[model samples]
Target chain A: MASRSPLLAALMRLPPPAPVLMAGSHLLTRLGRKMAGRHPGMIARLGPEAGKRLLLDATDLPALILLQAEPLSLRLFPRRAAAPPSDAQITGNLAAFLAMLHGESDGDALFFSGELSISGDTSAVLALRNALDDAEIDLAAEFAALFRAPETVVRRLAVVAGPRLGLSLTRMEALP
Target chain B: MMELVCPAGTPAALRTAVEAGAHAVYCGFADETNARNFPGLNFSRAEMAEGVAHAHARGAKVLVAINTFPRAGDADLWHRAIDDAAGAGADAVILADMGLLDYARRAQPQLRRHLSVQAAASNADAINFYAREFGVKRVVLPRVLTVAEIDEINREITVETEAFVFGGLCVMAEGRCSLSSWTTGLSPNMNGVCSPASHVSYETTPEGQDARLGGVLIHRTPAGGPAPYPTICKGAFTSPDGAGGRQTGHIFEDPVSLDATFLIPMLQKAGVRALKIEGRQRSRAYVAQVVRTFRAAVEAADRGAEMPVGALAKLTEGQASTTGSYAKIWR
Candidate 1:
């Protein structure tokens, strides 16, 4: 294979069985290996409080997660008990999970529909809700750097579908 | 003596109120033109005219409410409501929206206009702005002001002031809330409905019975417990504490109604022109009981008699009532 890019080299250096990325129904495991050589700080802003509060107040939460999907891959586990080789895994389906975060889908309804099943603290899920409302995620800048990448098809699909689906689903869910 | 304006949702309620010695009675068209757009309530235009005739013959005034905001591109309905109220010989028409106020002032300069509580004019500056701009003769202050604040406002304003003595309490500032719209796509300002019944759903599970509005779980009561309607702000929610624990309960307000009956004397002394009772969705019997009780209280106040003990407790929502932002210390 051609010499891996510097970004990929840095990502590979991180301890991993590696994270997975799930886009809508499409699932990709161990995808973060591609960016092994990249500086973590280039994207990960330091400090837990800053990160926590930023996520708590984000308005465009689904958009942020959708953009992140293009550059990072995460593993999907059936339950919290399932052994994961890496500690940095992020997992969830794009369409339904994003819908719930936007307040378009109710937790009870999605749980009943078997559309949402999470192994994490539900409070952490709510924290994500608050964070999305609190965070100021700039999709333009974040996506600009990754727009031309070969893997951006899923990200582009999410960009087009997330808001429209969220809005329509909210209306559907609102109706008696 | 300050006028005691009581609610009259039906013709029987109108007669009950007039008989019980209300100084004035306020009702609305049997349509969306009014704020209390509850089903099977309010009066028809003919009913209103007859009710006015009855109240007038009894030496009491009648005010018509055309208080809800007019929809975008559909101002004609509200204009017609104003004209109808004027044609029916209402003593005054209570209004809220600025555009509607201007239209009424231009269309029927001879008719008196009372500012509706939905305007949420809690301060003298806003009250003066309305009075100077629309020639508003009186203002029904929002439920958010304390007696001291009301006194301070009366000291500055030229128009007459009305304050709520009893009924439903709105915790949020009126005419400016969107929490209802965010949940149900309907709003008090736009649809004359808050926490509309159509969007509410209840579900029973092994854990509890969940009350939902627009599909969001707002409250979960024990299986056989009474389920309060899920009004967004009053709903139970979990909030995180600084030390990594959860605080679960009503972070805003508990489910309680407002009853400021004991403050009548203080309100009158504060230069109030009227004390308003706030339930057009209420039954005629409820109206009669409340009107009779308040009439006695107001008469006693006028004659310098001691205020009566509580008699309207059963009429309150949740079987519990509050003075609601009136004490200021509650804040």
Candidate 2:
């Protein structure tokens, strides 16, 4: 499994400015909707747990993310902003979160390694993790699809760039 | 040669385990029919069938775990799970409850039965009784047995024995712990979860990160440090030190998982037929890596080669592991 990316941490020495944050948040919101649309089974799999509000705190990033699961909405808040009320929170660095999202690292290993922190309603967090794992989301592919870019080229670029940049851009090799 | 029995919480994990060289993959339905019934985990009936077919296609067996005790006035649910597992083409059904075992024997004699570790059958007499009465072909020995004791039991019993070689170590006798139920009103034997996540919470207090189970503070880690899961047995606590003021520590058990990779050959020599890994609620990535590692270890043990040790330290709970009762170091 890919360890947490030190290169990513080094790059986040300065938080992104407000305009960039706004633009990224807008893009991510649309991406979240698209992902929910593309993988309806993931949401449905949560059963009665679809209404949970989860906080994703990337300790190295500029802002924290508050994700509302039912409507598939994602909103960003400055790291220093008043914390929103959430059912649960998962705190980790960007690389660890991305690696878990892309199946490059195991969530339990990350937690066991002290790279991730979990608080609040752990069952909701577990539900989200299981749903995301089943969905098999590929961050690189999701961005490529959202931008109408050719998936193969983007995938090749991600496969080449991901390691160097300390990111898990694409899904790990599928199990045979 | 000891078979590698891997756990799968989902169909994807099942496929991953089979591809990773598991001789047999164990799983359960998406209900309280088995332990590790965490949210969004386990398989539906259709998925179980497909998973069985997938594993079988790769020359691997699938064992469905309907291991939870059937609730009073709700045994039909457990009965249906057994029938569905058999229908899904399971090679065996791991069961713990006596009623369920007898039911499986009478209702589906063709389906093999493996006594679950939850039965806590740690001796030759109890194991032999289960084999004779319920036609149990294999018995998953509780984690409390030492290698010498296991060897002694093997000498007296006829059924194949399976022992946990890796993963979580219960502080109490398997299937008999009531700590979670006393605290949260949910028991693994009945509800299929110990320390059910719904009752667990964590917070960063002035002192440290506090983990609470059922609104009771269990563990307090140093500020910004990693906190272990709030299972009652693994929790930190404070109690009056008899004549003195008070003492605080993990009074029951430390937050460490069981890792017996170094004892594979010993367990094999003890007549263990299969080695079991314990995280059905873990991710597919975790399952794949662990199964692959144990497969190599099992193969090496067969070849009389040195087994890989400490390869899974990063994957263990609190990044710490113990040989558990296998070494009997306390004795």
Candidate 3:
């Protein structure tokens, strides 16, 4: 029930022109490649499912992301533009996507709660979710490890910023 | 006191459910030996052993589900599941197939046995037969029974009775429905999947979205409306109206999931020993939230306090719920 952080609000309101989207797409593609390198088991587990192009529509943001696991790529497009063809799609807010990526929230819970919606190939979407779950992709930790920053600093930043932004940024560990 | 039996689709969910105060958590192997054979779900053999250790360390029990019927020529897979569950130190094995029950009784006589709802034992005679023949210690009563009928069955049967208090409601008698098989060529009994996601697709239409199962148009929802999972039983069907025109609506049942939290007191009074929550195909978050909610409700029921109602509205399918056959509203 916390308000959206000013930084997130500003990002949401920012106009996503063609150049900006193209640049974001390039950056995401690089990030995706880096993650694929870090989590080889996740891609291997996906099998042929890694080839499917999954459209992730973040309703609270100004862009949509089309992701593919094999040969890792992530392309962003302006929200108002016509959607590209994809094998599956998941639609949700930015917070839901972030939380799911960080393992802080359950993907099935978000779907059941109507906070997220899925269309097209459900099996592929399920494969992606399972692959992600098995990988335990902690976004903050991954970024810190990738950039050689202090893990504690990154984790502490996520813990501090997550609630203020009404999002789950840190990975939720198993209950003791 | 009624024990809380929750579902755990994965090792993470098993730990979460146990931490959430579940007395016992039921799960299946990552195969068709049990029901809920969904993609990227269930536990591996090593994971099962670790999960059992985790639950036992936390003062909880793990019930391995070997409920699916064995294939005509492939009984070894089912037998291996039973053996693996016992090897993992599970507290009990829930069995539906008579052959599996016979095998478990003979092979691992020390392993406790529970009758699965998939067996659809709604009457005392069936319950007693399983107990007498298989030494089954408990029975997960089919969702078709009313509380009054449950009380009657409890009076006649010696084994403990477990009833589903939340999650999906099957209109057809469990273990008997062929609707999903007819549509998708898969069944909960054989393939361990109902309306298998591999056979499901969604198409955007001018009016809204059309959900199809096995290329059969099953449900259509308006734009911005909640679209329930494309289960054949809850699908919108067109039938004869008896007046020349056709009637288009849910012929078997609506898209409402079951929520009987308010009926805890009545069920407890009916001699129910355990309360089960469905959805092993769900995420750990779902498992945790539901387990916590039901744990509180069960404790409140034990104290003769009012049970919490409408706390899980958002979790129910179509954002709606019903008591299902528990109230016998259809009759």
Candidate 4:
């Protein structure tokens, strides 16, 4: 608890509702709703019917995802200080969640090894997990369609500058 | 002929096991009733039925393991599992707890009963008791016994015996130990999981990538090196010594896998009725390769031939393999 630097703590203490922050949140909410309606199967991979709201809390930075079934709502809450009520909650760090989502590591292995956890409404959570496993979901492929222009631009940039950038990032950290 | 009973964590693995010449395949439902209760493993009711049909068509049998202890108020779930197994046309149901066994005996005596190793029925007396009391037809002997002890048990009991010959080794008596329970509030007996991945963590630190179980450091390897899962028993720990110092090592058991293929002939001669392979949580490809290698090994052993060169070393991925308690020492 004491390890965090004073500067970082002071930054965290700043108020939440900045103009840029509100604009970013509004954009994200629209994106989430668009994705929900366009690709309902992605969220349904959790279950055909979400009997109760599921909260996916990325405990690292307090990002949250609320899932609802009736009208199919998927909302993202960033830097939430308080958790909302949920039927089931899956808790993990950003990297662990990404590893599971990207299939870089086996979800079951991660669950068994404690990298991820689900508490509350086990049956619903199991449904979600099984659906995800069966879905073979590739977020990268999904986003490639949504961000095709950006992806191509990034590719062009990478072709021109990948070596230099890669070299810099590769040795950014040094061993103590 | 000694039957080679293999594990199938998934339906595809079950089919692969049967195709690879497994005499019988054991699996569990995708729930807490079975030991391999991970996120994406085990069978559904429809899948279990499908698996049974697949195995039966191939002249192989399917055994369902509902081996975890029944919870205080949720015994009905365990009971329904036995009923479901019977409904799925399972050849037999592997069980552990005495209460659950009795429930199965009363509810579905028609279903054949094999005692799971989770019962820790290591001796003839305990094995005989389960046989006499609950009509257990076969006892999957615990890993703690030697071939001679197994032979003695076979001589004393009327039931058949199955011994695990390959895959992960249980450091402590599986169901009897609560090391994981103390650490994670979960154990094989109640939750049908051990050193559950839900409480496991792997983090890349300045030192290297380290594996921890329930927040306790298990093993730390250099960056980009292999980091083993910190199953509590296999984790390295330090203890106080008499000379005002600390002794740091794998205090319980080293991270070694059990590969008893070389003892096939000795085990057969010792009156073992079946050779079991562990790892129901493995892949179908892994299941196929191990099952094929062991199937050939079991056949060669039956014909009095020497053990073949191991092709399953790829499955272990460089971990040391041992014959475990089967290799008796003359101290």
The two-chain DockQ for each candidate, comma-separated, is 0.01, 0.65, 0.48, 0.06
| Candidate 4 structure quality by residue, lDDT tens digits, B1-331 | 7899998876766886898899999999978999988655688898899999999999999999999998787798899999999999999999999999999999999999999999999999999999999999999989988988888888998889999999888878857888888888887788987767567655546765566667877766564343344577777777898799998777787767789888889889989999999988765545667888999999999789988766665455224677788886764
TM-score of chain A of each: 0.31, 0.89, 0.90, 0.61
Q: Give the higher-lDDT candidate: 2 or 4.
A: 2
State which docking tier applies to candidate 4. Answer: incorrect
Q: DockQ score of candidate 2?
A: 0.65
On lDDT, the leading prediction is: 2
Flag regions of model 3 displaced more than 4 Å: A3-10, A13-48, A78-84, A102-115, A133-137, A172-176, B243-246
Error of 1 at A60 (Å): 54
Among all windows of 10 consecutive residues in model 1 chain B, the one with the lowest summed lDDT is B221-230
Whichever of 3 and 4 has more DockQ, that candidate is 3
The residue-by-residue lDDT of candidate 4 on A1-176, one tens digit each, is: 01334664455445445564556445545555555555554454444435567787665443477766545556656554566677777776555565444333444344444455555655456555544433334443334445554544444443344243221111111111
Taking chain A of model 1 alone, its TM-score versus the true chain A equals: 0.31
**Model 2 C-alpha lDDT per residue in residues A28-129, reported as the tens digit of each score:** 989988888888778877877789999999887878898977877788777876888998899988888988887667898887666887888888999999
lDDT of 3 by residue, A7-100 (tens): 8788897768889889989878877777788887677657668889999998888988999987688999777878999999998888888777
Interface RMSD for each of the candidates: 18.4, 1.6, 2.4, 7.2
- Show where candidate 4 strays beyond 4 Å: A1-176
* Residue pairs whose backbone atoms clash in candidate 3: none
Best by TM-score: 2
Candidate 1 - CAPRI tier? Answer: incorrect
Write the candidate numbers in order of decreasing lDDT.
2, 3, 4, 1
Better of 1 and 4 by TM-score: 4
